[model samples]
Target: MSEKRDMSRSRKLFITDKLMRLLLVGAASTSVLVVCLIFLFLFREAGPFALNPGLGKLLDSQWIPVSFQEEHFGVGPLLAGSALVTALAMLVTVPISVLVSIYIAEIAHPTEREFLKPFIEILASIPSVVLGFFGLLVVAPLIKTTFGLSTGLTALTGALLLSLMAIPTIISLSEDALVSVPYALKNASLALGASHLQTIFRVTLPAALPGIVAAVMLGIGRVIGETMAVLMVTGNSAILTASPLSSVRTMTATIAAEMGEVPFGSVHYQALFWIGIILLVITFFLNIIAQRVLKKYGMMK
Candidate 1:
């Protein structure tokens, strides 16, 4: 009788497990379906403009879209500016983020770390619009005076603001990764007479490289997708420029600024969809690379 009861209980538990798995799969399928639908909608809207003869015009630096007259759909300059902003922002963010992470995870005293971590979290929660406004009022003027640019809304200003926005993400992720490093490794290094710094550099950091890389990837994505803050500070000039001081417009800003003005079913409108597709592709690529790096790190350990 006891054996029969045990078998019945086991059967019930197995059925419950199968039901849970089915529910999880159903949720995942719904998410995938939603993403597919969005992509399909964007492609449908953007396809006509992408196929137009004037689509070649999008390669030019100047963006002048007229509703009645022949429309110019040049997105190249905007795309280039966006890339430059994200790249420069990363350059600025990476060093500071790594250092901050080091301080938070490995170096700081317990009391200080507790205090600092909350402040950092608070910084992360501040609205991007507030930052943007601050940049416009304070940073832009300072930049204008220092650089002697007529307008403060330049690529450098945008990049600076973006770096500020990205730093918290990098710091948070890197700190978590650093904290996950095995305690045994640190003790072993110390047992051999290595200093804390030596152990961190030689052991902890290398072990946490996957997490750091993932943080950077996430930072890049945030910078690339940012719209309002960049739009407010970037002078909104669609120009291809290698000069950091020059005024520029990023792809996200362009879409935000122009979408309402462009007529529906027009080539100009569809070109915006092309820009969306480009962003989608870039984000997808970064996520894939980040996932692979994380997987490699997991397997290595």
Candidate 2:
């Protein structure tokens, strides 16, 4: 009777394990399907962008999409705007976030770290639209007054706002990476007559490099995809300018500002989808690089 009972229990557990495995596989498959569908849809809408609008126009700086006579879909301005804002934002976000993470992970007392972590998370939880409003009302005026500019809506303003948004992400992930560095390694460095700061810079930070790189990439990705905040404060001008003080419109901003008013199935509409495809490709590459670094570090299989 006991032997029969044991055999029955084993059979039931095996069946349950198989059922759970199938459910996990199905969920993962569904996620992949959703992503593929999105890519396909964007590609379908953007197919005519090349032929009708002509890829030749992309090299031109003029982007008069809604002009009365001869509308041009020059993408140079949008790409430049995005690159400038994203680069500037990353320049500000990376150093500040990494420094703060290092302080939190290595220097701060436990209670202080506990207090700071919650604030970082809270900042992250704040909605993008609210930040947009703050930038529009507060930061914009400050920039305009300080720079003696006609208006405050410029690439610098958008980059500052985006940096504010990206900081929490970079800090939280980087703090975790820094903290994950083994205590034994630090002890060994200390025993070798190295000071705390030296050990951190030479040993801990290097060991945490992969994770830090991943965090920075993710932060850059966030800055690239941001639309509402940049749209609200960037003056929405699609102009080719190298100056950070100049008003500009990013690809995401262009899509947000124009998509609703644009007529569906028009060449202009497909052009917006093409912008989405560009953003999708950039973000995809960033994620791939991040994952590769993590995998090399044995953080992922």
Candidate 3:
């Protein structure tokens, strides 16, 4: 009787596990299906434009889309603007995020960590629109006054806001990575007469480097995809310039600000969809690069 009962229980457990695995696979497949559908939709809308004669025009530096004379659809300015804003934002975000993570993970007391972690996470929950407004009304004016600029809505302004938006994600992920470093490693370092800082710099941080790098990459992803905040603060000027203090616009801002007003089935509409495809490709490659980095890190370890 006991042998028979054991066999039945094992069989039931195996069936349950198999069912769970199938359910998870179904869910993952559904997610992939949704992404494929989105890509297909964008491609369908933008295919003609991609092949159109304007492909040459799209490579130019200017972006004059609405004119009785002729319309230009160059993406150079938008791409440059995005690159500048994201690059500047990362420069600000990465150092501060890593330092904050270090403080939260290695230095803070338990009570302080409890308070700081929730507080920092709450920063991410604040809506982008609200942050945009804050940037417009508060930071922009402050920047303008400080720099004596003609207007506050500059790429620098946008980059600053984006960095603010990205910090929480980086800090949270990096803190988790730092905290996950094995206690044995730290103890061994201390036993070897290394100071706490030395142990953290030499042992703890290296062990957690992979996760920290992942956090920064994810933060870049977060900053790059932001729409409203950059839209409102970037002055929406399609200018090809590298100066962060000047006004510029991003691919996301272009799509967001003009998509609704653009005539359906028109070249302008197709251009917006094309921009969407570009963004999708950029993000896809970003994720791929992130995976590669993680894999390389794993191998190095």
lDDT of each prediction vs. the true structure?
A: 0.88, 0.92, 0.90
**Model 2 Cα lDDT, one tens digit per residue, 82-125:** 99999989989999999999999999999998899998889898
Per-residue alpha-carbon lDDT of candidate 3 for residues 167-266, written as tens digits (9 for 90 to 100) = 9999998887888888999999999999999998899989999888988887888888899999999899999889988999999999999998998989
Q: What is the lDDT of residue 173 in candidate 3?
A: 83
What TM-score does model 2 achieve against the real structure?
Answer: 0.92
Question: Which runs of model 3 end up more than 4 angstroms from their true locations?
Answer: 1-25, 295-301
Indicate whether candidate 1 or candidate 2 has the larger TM-score: 2
lDDT of 1: 0.88
Best by TM-score: 2
Off by over 4 Å in 2: 1-23
Worst 10 residues of 3 by lDDT: 292-301
Q: Model 1: what TM-score?
A: 0.88
lDDT of 1 by residue, 1-301 (tens): 9999999999999999999999999998998899999899999998776556646766765677764765567778888899989988999999999988998899999999999988888877889899999999999999999988789999999999999899988999889889888899889999999999999899889889888998899889889999988989999888778888888899999999989887798777888888888898888888888878877777223
> Which pairs, if any, clash in model 1?
58-74
